[model samples]
Target chain A: MVEGKKYRQFRVNKHLKRLMAKHYALGRYQRYWGRPLHRKLAWITSGAPVELLRAFKIYSVYPEQYGAICSTAKATEKLCQAAEAAGYSQDLCSYARSHIGSILRPDLAPMQGLPKPDLLVACNNICGTVLKWYEALAHLLKVPLLVLDTPYLPGELTEHAHQYVLEQLQNMVRQLENLTGRKLDMQDLKRQMARSAEMTKFWREIRELAQAHPSPLNGPDLFIQMAPIVAVRGSQEGIDYYRKLKAETEERVRRGEGAILEEKTRLVWDNIAIWPKLFNFTKMFTERGACFVTDTYSGGWAAELASGDPLESLAATYTNIFLNRSPEFRARQMIELVEAYEADGFVMHSNRSCKPYSLVQEVIRRRVMEKTGVPGLMVEADMADPRAYAEESVRTRVEAFLETLQAL
Target chain B: MEDFFVGVDIGSLTAKVVLVDAQGQALAWAVDRSGYSGRDVAQRLTQEILEEKGIKVEQIKVTVATGYGRVTYPAEREVSEITCQAKGIAHFFPGARTVIDIGGQDSKVIKVLPGGKVIDFAMNDKCAAGTGRFLEVMAGALEVSLEEVGALAVKAEEHKAISSFCTVFAESEVISHVSAGALKPDILAGVCDSVAARVSALVERVGLEPDVVFTGGVAKNAGVAKALSEQIGYPLLIPENPQITAALGAALLAWGMG
Candidate 1:
């Protein structure tokens, strides 16, 4: 009934809500269910190797996702202020700040601040901030902290980086095992990796389905649907979820249906989503008949797991994360998305809370423009903090960018 | 019935309205302070423009609203200030390849291709450092009118550097310079140069294109324009009345292609 909502809703939205509700409810009442099931709940980063933790029978919860939920619930400003009051700088990642704030002040947090973690796991494959965030959490919660340090790949993953990550992953196995009082199950690990690989493949296929004319999925859809994959990847539930979502997407593509009624312009989105303004932002594009055919953020989870030994493969997969790579790699990835999706243009979110992602964006924008010859529009905002979102400014840039594509 | 098109740009500081015929020629234009009631001001301006041109409401075929308060104002359609500025600049200067628009609240550098198309753009983040608002605050700090600050800066014999580009911090820096008995003209010059430097960085990101057209209210400030031109190393071609560029572009869009 909104004025700017010209796009069709995905039928799976109800299913997604149900699934995410169940996932969050599981985390909410983990103290009740987890103890009896002999499962340890570990609060992990989005990019952490959760499959390994899952292999150790640890139920993983992503604080970053919860930070988003907190943001969507309009609790980020208050939560971030709480973190800032606790000596955390405002310049830190908003997700980390808000999560830490929730940890410190659970009364003001969503879901009473993600059930107390039995252990904490962090992987620096996403960003360097996670290690420090998890470190602070480990110190606060007095829980064992396991860290996977994936070295940044300025270029190709060298033998040294691969070995370094593999060693840490192996070390992680021991740490997780020690914390859970369980031995490493090789068969279970292999099965989990297989499921993870399958789920990633399905996700990739679902994204590729956007290559179809009038894209089956828009930017928000990709961002929202990617939740289960990030939180519960390598599980049967995740695999089944993606399988269903991908099938419906394929059906949409087959039926020649697009996320928006008339996909006049197709675009590629970069950086993490503006969680608080996802729907409103999506409408800005969709209402103008612009559909984001693909994005580099959600696609980070859709990367194919490298082949070979489980630890070695994860080392390659996680270390070679698009964010951990060079700006050259990022630009190429963006250009490839633009080309693959046949995008008319691209929009880069110059997120304020994310330095690693936002800092090199201008360079990436220039490179993408030179290579793809498609215009790249950079709009400034934050990923989680609604306070940083200037609705008028963002709308101006997006509308202009869409008009540029229309002119072309 | 005579067909007309209307474009209203309700910017943070000012609201602009442009009326054009079906052929995209500007017939009447108006600019007024936006104040707190942008929607009311925009409506008043639209009525004024229509009456001044002796045109009835029914004669307006399309209305496109733009700028920061564009959403608040009801119109037949809405467009972003970026596209409007690009279109307006292209209408005046067909060879325009780049546009630098510094409004009251935000500053933007747009890379424009041939035929009024914006290929790329980079805007200042949620900061008021390199915008008209920055200059206004600085002007107030210097106890001079915003209009006089520009001409006064042009008469400076010495230029001092303002280290902080942040509006709040820079205000303190300006006060400190004043306390140190720095010449008012020099301080004003430094402020203009600082804004120019900050905006030039954004211009470099989108790339510096020849025949760069500067639009928005800040373009009227001769000192800022001179400093900006020097920073980018390309002379800026400002419109006759730079503030109405976006509004004009919106009106042109409402007029549609010939």
Candidate 2:
């Protein structure tokens, strides 16, 4: 206790309890760090791949996820130092820098008996930083490496990409055979993809189910749906999982279930999940009985677009959807998702680390409002880098946003 | 028996390890998803290979680490990615003076001076538009895996380049191409042309040389590497574990570590 300071420790905690409730993290902080799977070491991580790892029960670490973990508990500075020592420029990806630093210095990125990954996996879908970042790591580890490839299709994926991609898929299938020493049965693979497609359809239908006077789906459940969607997207398990989800949702609608309290507003949310703190985001609305009618994840079901045409469908998959299209297409898709789901407002996550996606999000937001008259909120945060996420500021913004929506 | 050395490159997407004798002769290599424990991953993989070859870890002269995990490696010293790449490339193709290394996390164009010193370099570590990870994610958008981008790109009938450097914009463009009824192979070829064009532009930024060697993980892609080679008017000298060039350079640096 400072003798002359009546308020040294009393700083900032006052206003934080006030308006921060609206954007206050509504999710519980569950510890995911524990015993890992019986597996090889090494982790190739992008922001979204963290969820994939969780689904596969893979014991890997994502530096951004670690940043999220660190920020929630306040340990980013030390990690930052370690990265600096590794000769990694401080200006690079903060998450990557922190992770690299941790790798360069063990005390910072400490884990239990850190084991190396047998393989590394990365998809350039999020950003290009990962490839070179991984390139360096692959060399240091000297482990068999694998990379998931995507061609840049800024305006639209050409029809040629379908065949191009299919051929690549065949190659990947072979690569997997070499890696896992487990054969991917054609029947099983097809069944998995079909199931995933089916689940996507069911989830899409459930998103539609929210069109009633009171939506059948709530924010809480809306967030949980991402699991099957992400974990089993190209496999049958996702489809089977979504089937059960759709059935239960149908029953919930039949029984007059409202996910949130009073079920008054229909909101459309566009952006990636703050997985490190998802429950908080959902709780902010669901406790209010606000049904989140639509999201990009709901529209991730282009598998049916190529239904029965796996090879061709796979090739054509990325080119046919708004999610994979230009910002104009995405703008239009957001407009449509709002209309189809009859959302009353829009919540757009302006994630910082993901500048590419968030770049035109404002344009999309304006277009959506002009096209649909639904107000949108541009909630900013790091896709996964905790340093970029301003929880207090976002909470304040959301609270005001909901107030305005309620006034409407 | 001569001393042996090991190099490991741990990236955001993949982990790779390479083994070499004192002469820098490539022995064994592995690539895997790095869960954690990159050091153990490196040590164990090296051990497994050595054991298989009836050798021991101590029998090896030195170990070096590079990529995103170089310094933290359980080794004597860590070298800059640029330095390691120069060494790795020089070892593979003695005549090489320039190198283009595209990995999941970053893309680098290096000007290798005589004696494996990096004279100058340019790198794109921010966006995926021109890096390997871009192709990885686009694979999903294109409905393929990371490994298949090259072959698919080779099938393009029309060379329509995907012009967007931004992945989001590219997504929109890819969808439009698909809906417009363009042939899948043609579209894929366009993307390949686009990626190669971006890479070529980067390479040109640092000034290209007569003999350019493409290192890093992407060099293994027969399609894209070949496309890159054609675009640059030179043959790409890719090592068996092309991704490990940076780490091998670091491992080779072990010779200087003491």
Best by TM-score: 1
Model 1: per-residue Cα lDDT over A290-313, one tens digit each: 888999999989889998888888
In model 2, state the lDDT of residue B239. 77
lDDT of all the models against the reference?
A: 0.88, 0.62
Q: Give, for candidate 2 chain A, the lowest lDDT window spanning 10 residues.
A: A22-31
lDDT of 2 by residue, B1-258 (tens): 668877777765677777777666677777776668666676667777788778777777777666665546776645456667788788778888888988876777877767676555555534676777777766777787777777777877676568898888887787788888876667766766667888898787557896788877777776678678889888777777787777666666665442
Please identify model 2 stretches exceeding 4 Å from their true place. Answer: A1-115, A154-156, A173-188, A232-244, A276-291, A297-311, A318-323, B1-258
lDDT (0-100) at residue B21 of candidate 1?
92
Report per-candidate DockQ: 0.75, 0.01
lDDT of 1 by residue, B55-107 (tens): 99999888899998888777877778888888899999999999999999989
TM-score for each predicted model, relative to the true structure: 0.94, 0.47
Error of 2 at B59 (Å): 91
